[model samples]
Target: MQKTNKIRVGTAAVLAVVLGVSSLIGFSSSANAAPVTINFWSRGAQADFIASVGAEFNKINPNIQVKVTTIPDAEFVQKLSTASQSGSAPDITSVDLILVPYFAKNGVFEDLTSYTNGLSFKSKLSPAHMALGLYNKKQYALPFTAEASVLFWNKDLFKKAGLDPNKGPKTFAEIEAAAKAITALGGDYKGFYFSGACGGCNIFTFAPLMWASGGDILTAAGQPTFTDKNVAKALSFYNRLWSKGYVAKSAKTDNGASFAAPFAAGKTGMVGAGAFFVGSLKANPEINYGVTPLPGATGGKGSFAGGDNIAILKGTKNPVEAKIFLDWALNAGQKFIATKAILPIRSDIAASDYVPQDPRYKVMADAMAYGKTPYSVAYTPLIADGQSPWVKMLQSAIFDGKIAAAQAAAQKQALAIVKKQG
Candidate 1:
């Protein structure tokens, strides 16, 4: 049986332990004349989900209310940086997971080793996400939401192309062959689709191929290794498909805007995307889809674990209220996310906890387990920046067929950027 209790002022509240899952919080309530507000800043792309989570949070914790601010993804880093430097940072923020290392390195977030260690699900949290939130052995954040880049195949299109609708490609060759067969159907039938000109999108989707094939573009210490053979193979994989005209033309020009339109409309056979893709296509039940972790050229599978990490800012005045919210996030908060059809932070969450939802969630979960993220303090300039060498490298290799030149230039540019960060 479950019990309910309203948290009171200045008293330590023990979060109810339920279903073998538990969390501990001993923070005293904020001694404020006015009701304490926990300002939670979430990126615009994630604002809707964050707003829903905020509403649920207010329901149980009557003493504290989370104020959510939606910052456009394009301006989040700049706005947050300005706020942090001027000593006006939000009580807590959900930052892009890949940028966690960058923020931690720059001392933008509070050290949460003590708090994170207390959470029971800390051990079960996504490893890729946990690793990102660490800097100098100090934990700065906890995964708020998880998004794993996995392969999405249109099952109906597969059957129409004379392929098995149930079986998705497990290797690059299989993917290519599937594309060929699908493309043979001619008019508007795309075999494989990609955001050829989008750096972030490519890294989210394409880098996993290199990872699966035992190739990595960065050393653990934030050094660039872009000239690896695995990277060449991954880029060449797209080059082969593009050269054969099996890829959609939109791919060459897509700079991340509406990249999924082709695939979601059931015209494209295979593409790489994340959980948000499922949410976007939810209204279109007309298309039968199947998902798998991105596969290597020969056989291995992997994904880019991308999404947001929740961390209390370094100078928050409402530490107690902020921590109370954080504690709730690790338990009930995760349950809330599951209800929204988003992936939970904890790997151990029961299937019953999530929406009786897409059966393909298992694929996303496996991808999360199998995935890894690049750890670098120079992440913005190296990968996420619009003008980064990564996008140019992909374009040069995939579209211009300048693999050697592209690799050399990218390596040199990457080294320069990382050196500047040092």
Candidate 2:
């Protein structure tokens, strides 16, 4: 059996507030009225945060109670699949952004376009996140959180390499130069690290490099275009770095789950990461680090806009109540940003003073302006089957010394997968 936790209201003050607000709104007056409970599921790591939000929501809407179940990341999709088949799915779920298209296509989620159309906050959501929720012009999901992949460097390591600790690489050439400088110091330290074995990580960090160079992994029709010149150029750049011994040896075996450990441990000089990395690095006070937008291949910056989307499942018996909860949570705006430390999904929040004034956060906020997601249709099938072909291609290029062969094979496999999905 899967582990589960249920949040219940026990505080008198909280109950008083719930009753007071309901009475003021003329929603309910009887203290003995039983609340209608709705089931919600989210990633296990965010169980506490979601539980808090659920508690607060219960305070305002006394008629509806939300029971949140936290599921492990690796098992979430499979568990949801099992539940869907058995007619036991939760009313609401928080889904990984990239998987939204696949779920929507399979009719696992309800089309929320009509419900969201009348809401003012609907227009405020980030376009990049909106792209993930749209399928055939229908909206099936709403943005829950936002994040972008960026470059992070250790200031202490930079200083030892005789490089300015205050400045970060803005172009591929600069990154290459910095990597060489740091590697020259020798020992167990490596200049850079990334998960070569993780396909999701490759899409998060490496695809942006290709995008910044005017290349894309998939065409508009959702077909594989990895053989495109721009992508090949980015691959060649990585091949060069791998051949020069600048990347950590562990990169070959590390998956997305543990890729950042070496960077946090102070063994790696630079890493490509997202906002969550900030908290992880802060936990290690000894490693002084700085962040910047990911450098472009030739020049400029790029980032993979990523996060989760919230949706009501098609089998939900409380669609109206679910919509109400979603609208309230999203309209909380700055409160959500402060609590989550994530990029604001709302256009109004992104532009307002609600964001932190710190420089590190500023870099991430600015990167959001140019950040992009891969074409959703293509990306859906590529990642849905299991380990992505693109990831296999990367491993092949780095470990097997077969860049050309890997690129060719990946293109073939990607095209087949996309076509079959269609």
Candidate 3:
């Protein structure tokens, strides 16, 4: 993650003053104090887990109650936007990492720097995940969970291709060679799979390839850097795989959500995706799979660290109560690691025995050391505009056979978007 020293200490100082005053007032009126209720909205998949955590928290702090509402992932952002405008937003909400900057920039969240600084476990949070919560040097959100993209290879397919099933590809050349070997087997199986048209999917799985090659789409200053030679090198590498018929045809139109279907169905030898793919693969039970960190252009590894972040909305009536819930929810790392089979945002818990003992999950856990989030300013507009120039660039290069022109056009458009955000 890119670090900027542009700290807004003033925001923390202001929040501290408000919190101090509220504490004194609450101390004086303890006998007459009423129960506090805070509304929390989160994505559907984590609803049950979050509600369970809330139940645990309420047992300890009987004066505070949490009301959790689950929203469909597809409609979360749109609904949050509507609620924010109408002053009906929940007191607290969990948002995708990519949407954090857009909300922070639009003044929809409250700065939590002071609260975070006060926590005993603050330093135990993953820096890469915490970096996602930052906007204009202020911590407006907190890392709720963490995931890393990795390459999932079918060991059975590898064995059939005459390659060692235990050894996963570690370089772009190795990946290509392995794909070629698998494709040479005449069957309905494709060598590789990915969502070619899905912006978020490609960014999560492919941007790390660019990073591992020592290239980035944007600088810390939020300037476009996609025209770099290494960027082109990585993009061209994908073009080669697509052009050679190694990638599945369904990839051309697969949205990120369903791209893993081919791999799960045992129709593809390898798929690049996040830890969630483990669930799908496990359900099949027939495809013997192993996970590895995404291979670099040379031999290094890089991954995109992604997950939802929790934040307090700007107009919450009970900021203090909301903070209590936020801290409690995030601190329940053991529950998430044990129950969800997902990594915790807290480094201490992630490194503890609470994490799964399975070796496959270790691939993702180890990759977190070198994982990164995109520079937020560049990412926000790219997502908001619904125009992923990188995906288009790949489409042009592989499908339209216009590599050079596509690279030039993408760089120009990406630069314009970043400059406009400035």
Candidate 4:
């Protein structure tokens, strides 16, 4: 056997690997062990799916049972933080990828470098998500579910507007043309819709468009690039649509309360949304739709990788059992995840690997090939906040037509905030 260097980290002793024992521990069945129950916490929306996975795990490892708890998502962070500080955290946590940096930096999560390295599919994890969980160059969490932003064109409406029902727009001009045609339908018909005042929604949709043209909201140094030409062009494209009255007026002040309502109601021809939208539209089967990756001004496509990453919190009684769950989640458990129309964390898994009720599920999963997540410790403050400079910039440019001024002001504010927060 080859000798390897090993090191222990923090309270969990997240060991380094010589020849990873963690892998063997994770892969072997846990039925031989004494009955042990581990606590697992998941955000409210994911609780049902999580509980099912837990039940499945128990079916195979009868002795190592997992108890799943639902944590209201709005209070999840604060509660988790407090519990982590008191060393009363759960054995396993399904953490939002964006929150990984904060927890990883504070050492709230156990270092899983050895176990992660041992996984055969480790290289298949999203690079952006993996990087988010890094602290001092060590891995902490693995992506759990994957969400990607996709453009949705109403197929019935497209056919009504004389556009090809079978084809969706692929560039800025095409989107504009399609929107204009749809709006010309008169009475209760609008070309496009967006939640103008929702920062999170924009990141899921608009940010991908910003990135499609080889531009980014954050520079390599983790600073703002709101003033990038590509960004301005993308914003301007929307501004023109708004100015031409191609976008629904409700979109101007929607504030996310009725974000996707117009589209779901069949009152709008197109919208940008994620996997949840596909699921949400199940009740609106009357509205036929097609999904495509958000497109750039000239060409290319992009999407924001939004979802949770699973990790073992620092003081768990059963790291081995936790490893078993995490391993299964990234490996065997992926079958269930993909079945739900979500992309698997492992790149080797594709949407076509299984049949989907909605063929667009294939489009959503296929988008992962070009999906990305931004890097910044101040993501919530500078981007997710509805009143943040980033969001306000979009409102200013699209609603107020202050394109140049908005970009400059937002760029400055974002930089100062990022610098101070860092």
lDDT of each: 0.85, 0.78, 0.78, 0.82
In candidate 2, position 368 carries an lDDT of: 64
| lDDT (10s digit) by residue, model 4, range 347-412 | 667543532556777777677657888767687788767779988999999999999899999989
Clashing pairs in 2: none
Best by TM-score: 1
Error of 4 at 384 (Å): 1.5
Per residue, candidate 3 scores C-alpha lDDT tens digits across 285-329 of: 999999888877997888988877899999899998998878776
Pairs that collide in candidate 3 are none
Q: What are the TM-scores, per candidate, against the unseen true structure?
A: 0.90, 0.87, 0.85, 0.85
Superposed on all Cα atoms, the candidates' RMSDs to the truth, in angstroms, are: 8.4, 9.0, 10.5, 8.7
Model 3: residues with Cα > 4 Å off, grouped in runs: 1-36, 44-65, 72-75, 378-380, 383-386
Each prediction's total of clashing residue pairs, residues at least 3 apart in sequence or on different chains, is 0, 0, 0, 0
Highest lDDT model number: 1
Per-residue lDDT of model 2, residues 59-177, tens digit only: 88888888888897667778887898789999988887777877888899999888768767776777777888999899999887777889999999999999999999888888888
Candidate 4, superposed: residue stretches over 4 Å from native: 1-35, 44-48, 72-74, 355-358
